[model samples]
Target: MLHIKNITYRVAGRTLLEETSLHIPVGHKIGLIGRNGTGKSTLLKLITGEIHPEGGSIRLQNGAKLGVLPQEAPSGPESLLETVLDADIERKNLLNEAETAEDPQRIAEIYTRLADINSHTAESRAAKILTGLGFDFEAQQRPCSSYSGGWRTRVALAATLFAEPDLLLLDEPSNYLDLEATLWLENFLRNYPRTLVMVSHDRNLLNNVIETIVHLDQLKLVKYNGNYDFFEKTRAEKLALDAAMAKKQDTQRKHLQSFVDRFRAKASKARQAQSRVKMLEKMKPIASAMEEYSVNFSFPSPAPLSSPIVTMENCEVGYEATKPILKRLNLRLDMEDRIALLGPNGNGKSTFAKLLAGKLRAETGQFAKSGKLKIGFFGQHTLDDLHPEDTAYQHLVERMGNGREAVVRSKLGQFGFSKDKSDVAVKKLSGGEKARLIFCLLSIDAPHLLILDEPTNHLDVDAREALIQGLNEFEGAVILISHDPHLVALVADSLWLVSGGTVTTYDGDIDDYKKQVIDQARNGGSGNSPSAVSEEKQPNSGKARGNSKEARKARAEARALLAPKKKAVQKLEKQIQSLQQEIEKLEIKLADPTTYEKGADYQASVSTEIGRLKAEQEQTEENWLIALEELEELENS
Candidate 1:
């Protein structure tokens, strides 16, 4: 167990946490959630003793081992697997000591200690963790310097998980993961035997893995008894109640002041007025809930587009002609298409999105677009491509040609930049602010289609929500490549699976895709690998011919059998959505100040209704999973 007792932390005179106390029992999975800059990461550092608090103390049970995901990847020529294995510092130290120990008993003691720490299996365990996090066998053997920064970050995460500490602290572990690895990680953490504290913005991950939520609000930590969804509802209720109480107290204070003013001059009422004044002074003032600042904007309506916005026939896309990442792909994007490209990282999802956006040329076959097509493409490197010296106003003005300053400022303001902020250098802006600027630029003359590649990389919850709202209202066709399941589920109407050098429409939703990835990972497939696309065309063999027809027939029969399961899954999806809507409605009613004024009975009834709806939502989700599993079994059979 970890105990935080009245902890206070400050930086540069700003109090991030003050008198905050929390108790996390062993084996409890808790999510540290708050707005982006509210010290979620700092709190993790404090727990690990990287930084000391201004007051109070954090205590862990004696002999407790804690592991933290390092912000900086260890730099060396060591192989990836070796670097991860090095996380077992005690075991490494024992081995080093044994090499120089002169006495046989000392050597024996060291070997015994190594065995106690399971040091013999450390390499294999590290390899497994590396593989699960998207490294292949060859990649894991490569030196740490050979990997890019992102891959190194993943290696760090793998090493942290490999350490198997009693208390693990993970800060946004899912941020670097694709959907497949994220799913695998969720399963891994669900079965984790020790206490875990993670800070994440991934809703699906939090919902599926965490059992408790520790929310940082106004320099205080508040614990919620359930997952992210539960925390949201619980927090909403608390805020609503707080707001109501504040309003009521304000009303009473005003009434008392009015009476005091009227009766203070009357000798008969002097004593009564004095008593009222004293009572008012003694009454504690209720603090209103802190309102979070959020960006508010929408994409401009897209220019008119042809029915088929874009089309590809037998397209091959890659940077090099000799080696294409994807090939023989047939795809079409209609005006109403809202497609999310699903695949592991570096498996041609971004390549496909680029092909659709005209950023990459097809190596072979026809790639056609409607004459009216104009695409707004945002890629992972889009922010990096911005002119750092230019202000937001300058960027907009340059893009808008001769547009008026007022118009440019108005556009920037809509995207969360105020008059003063619009003049700040782009280089000084945070990544999320830069992303917002990109969106603003994209909306100037809205294109017929938008291609977004990892748009939510640096965005906070509010910014992500704003982006979702904008996408929901976008009139143009959208081809999104994102690892965020929440955004994909809410904005994408269809899914395009880009794998095995083939881009095909997936018959199911995001949930179905998640299950497929998880299954693929469990079946010894590196989800990050290019979907086994054969580069060379092989001549048809007699043995292959004998099995081809029967294999085709079997697959057809399986697909046919999958129809009802798919329908069932879709039905459950609708039921879940309906229940969620009903729950949101109930929550909205509870949030209303008038609802609380109706008395305790009314409030209790509203709470009960919300609870019932949440229960139904959970059960509906379970049924959805069953339907999905049935569909998978049929498809795999």
Candidate 2:
């Protein structure tokens, strides 16, 4: 749907894109992946015609619709719903025109075009997208101004989704998404029925969404017809091959030059040598693309000692104690706690995190932080903590405490801030630069109680993965609140579900958390009882919000009709039993010396298969119970 030819763009005397040509064919869900400051955002602008390239052309075929998930909020005091629905202004205008047609023929014509215009019906579309993107009913009603910057970005996203453009351009669509929302979005784009292009630092999201990798480097584009993993493997091989080819060319050129120099002095061999020299001079050099070594970072090693990390009892926390966001919350952290704090917006995930960090106090509760809890809290608004006036170095030194000048500089270098940027004031740094600096500052101590509110915010994919790995390896308690489903899945072994102004503990599974959170919200807000996988609901479909008392009755009826069969439930129980037995047999075999083949392979393969079976069994059992409960509730009536 979009085509670019030799597009080159530059700003502030630095080239962003040069001789970059790409053809984005119709209906391809393309994920734009790259490091921060590598012009992923700039490329999106070029495609949308918001920013023009200095050279070449970006051509979009006629009748193609373009949509972009805007990061910057356009001037507005609208509610989240208002902001999203406003994107359909053109349709609203057309709808208005149709209402007042002057003649019968005109009325018929307007009626014919009415399908294309439905701004009045935006409330339904906005709700559907917002719910899919992780907003509950309470959040949907919130004014955009009241939301934090991250939540506001979600509002902007809802607006973008509402436009229903043929070419969807998403920048960090998963930044505010919970696991449920991320999966919903994945399923949406997977069946988007149009073209997709997004810039994300998320590996799983990119792998699941995009078919090709468009590598941007030194103002040139290299298209790899592969996913992120495929691109990485291919990229290494391609570079090695290029290096060898370049070396061979250099050797040939050197040999030709030496022969020319020596033979030039001999009358008999001069012509042949001269011919070789000319041929060498005329040959185009085989230039190798620049290869940069990936940077590595290390957090300080911990001293041997403590076990239990952070403990909370009867915690009633919020900005104030009497009016708590969460009440009667109890939690304990072992030495190796990989806890993910999961919930929707305004459900007090960050508030609870801050309370744990001792940054804020619970109004009416006791928090006994175990044994000099070396706390490292990653604020959701990581960039906001950075002072505009202070240099990145100054913040690092101030928050991270004094380190050797060389050591401090080295830490900064790992995050991509070089000699000059390392010293540049945090105020002057770009949003992404500010986020990178936060990583350098926050991990300075390797505190036992590491509280990360939203570490991945504003980070491109590579930096995000680096941060996730760094967190994963730390042998301390981690309390992280993030919307990145993949990150949560990778790091969390436990979950704290904050919902309905109450907190509950659950073992962490990214998919399970989503199902429970949505189930709770659906029950409370909509009185709807739709099964999780039952034809995939779009009740938030249509073009309106919902229901009266009687409508709820219909939803309750639909819920009952789809309840699971008793025979199927019995079969699932048997499958679960068989799987458990098999897992036990594998464990016993792996433990014995003779039965195991290839220590690592046997252990890894068996463990992987066992984990998958266990997960499937658990899900089947949960779905069965929910279905049974619905049936019982229905039959009683």
TM-score of each prediction = 0.78, 0.74
Model 1, 1-637: lDDT tens per residue? 8999999999988899999999999999999887766889899989999899989999998999999988788768999989998898888888889889999988888898888888888887788788888888998889999887877889999888888899999988887777777888998899898899998877877899999999998899999989999998888898899999999999999999999999999999999999999999999987667665558656766656667777788988899635899998887888777788887787788888888877789889998988878888898889988899999999998999958988888888889888888999999787778989998998887787999988887776678888897776566778898878999877777777777777876655666566556767777775563232122322333344335334434533543465457658868998998998999898999999999889999999999999998998898899889889888776666
Q: What 10-residue stretch in candidate 1 is worst by lDDT? A: 529-538
- Candidate 2: list runs displaced more than 4 Å: 70-83, 116-123, 137-149, 243-293, 397-404, 427-430, 514-637
Task: Give per-residue lDDT, candidate 2, residue 397.
Answer: 74
Candidate 1 backbone collisions, by pair? none
Residue-level lDDT for 223 in candidate 2: 82
Candidate 2 structure quality by residue, lDDT tens digits, 1-637: 9888999898898888988899988988777776667788899998888899999999997988889876586445776776787787676666688778688898777766665565446678778777766666776777777766766776777787778788998887787765556656765676677888888777777787788888876677778887888988898888788889888888988889989988888999989988997898798976565544343434444444465566678878777424777888887777656778766656778788887778788677777766666776668666776788988787777775776778778788877778788787777676667877776676677666677777776776666667776665455667878878778867776667776776676432456555654564444433122222221353432222122223434533433343334335556677778877887887787677764657787778877887887788788778778767755665455
After TM-score superposition, what is the CA distance of residue 368 in candidate 2 from its true location, in Å?
Answer: 0.8
* Candidate 2: clashing pairs of residues: 201-461, 321-363, 376-451, 377-451, 378-451, 378-453, 388-427, 391-425, 538-541
